[model samples]
Target: MYVVKSPLPDADLKTVADALQGALVDLVDLALVAKQVHWNVVGPRFRSVHLQLDEVVASARTHSDTVAERASALGVSPDGRAATVAASSGISSVPAGWVKDSDAVGALADALGTVITRMRQRIASTAEPDPVSQDIFIAVTADLEKHHWMFQAENA
Candidate 1:
């Protein structure tokens, strides 16, 4: 059983909150990309991409929850509030107009790169709280990178 730790250093609390918020915000962007790809995907690979999009979104949501809970465990509030996520997220927003199916993958790749960069920054700065958060970020990065590569290959 996992025992929750209390009285975390205030500095580490802030660091962990920032890290969690960043990850969760990126996760929301991941969800958005998946939805965009699902809705806009066309051509021979349509069904495959569509299915994968939904699957990826589901995974993103799960990771978001895990990050949020981890923040709570560390005596920090989840920083995934909508306004904070929107204002602080590093992921580039999708344009307002319609997106081409082929181009959607590239857009998602950009967002993935943005998220990875932010997580890597956090990994560099965070000194404590819990190692699990960093591990989660790393795992998410791996999955997101793989997704980006698959989409990039398809784009070619």
Candidate 2:
């Protein structure tokens, strides 16, 4: 689908909003998986990974909520439903029992990093329509990057 209603007279804002929506779906999926990992993780790193997964889930939920709000602020309907997010999310899902004990956390970390990179690119695409939205996207990207790095280190 097109990013905005019409053209918005500026391409940048729409791009930023699109980036936000994309990020929103990803965060929603990541957060849900984090929660699942937290609940189902077993084996050697059980306690540690479980706790870390809880933290990741919390952050993911917040980011998802923020991105949805950002999209709403820009007059775009946020695809906040779980089914919608799951169907459209760019991250590949790890089915139940398909996740390895060692890879659970790392996969989430990788997904976060990937989403952050894409969000930055979209933020650049929106340089003309709205600076405020661009800034918001940047902030979200930075946060996701930090989260990704933290997960990488934690999982290491």
Can you tell me which runs of candidate 1 are displaced by over 4 Å?
1-5, 127-129
Residue-by-residue lDDT tens digits, candidate 2, 117-141: 7777767766667676677777777
For candidate 1, what is the TM-score? 0.83
Using all chains and alpha carbons, the TM-scores for the candidates as numbered come to 0.83, 0.81
The total of clashing pairs for model 2 equals 1
What clash pairs does model 2 have?
12-126
Task: Please give, for residues 1-156, the per-residue lDDT of candidate 1 as tens digits.
Answer: 565565757677677778887788888767876686678777665677678678778878888888788777776666666777678777777765555666666777677677777777766666356577777777777777787777778678
Best by the TM-score measure: 1
Per-residue error for 154 in candidate 2, Å, reads 3.6
| Model 1 lDDT, residue 36, Cα | 67
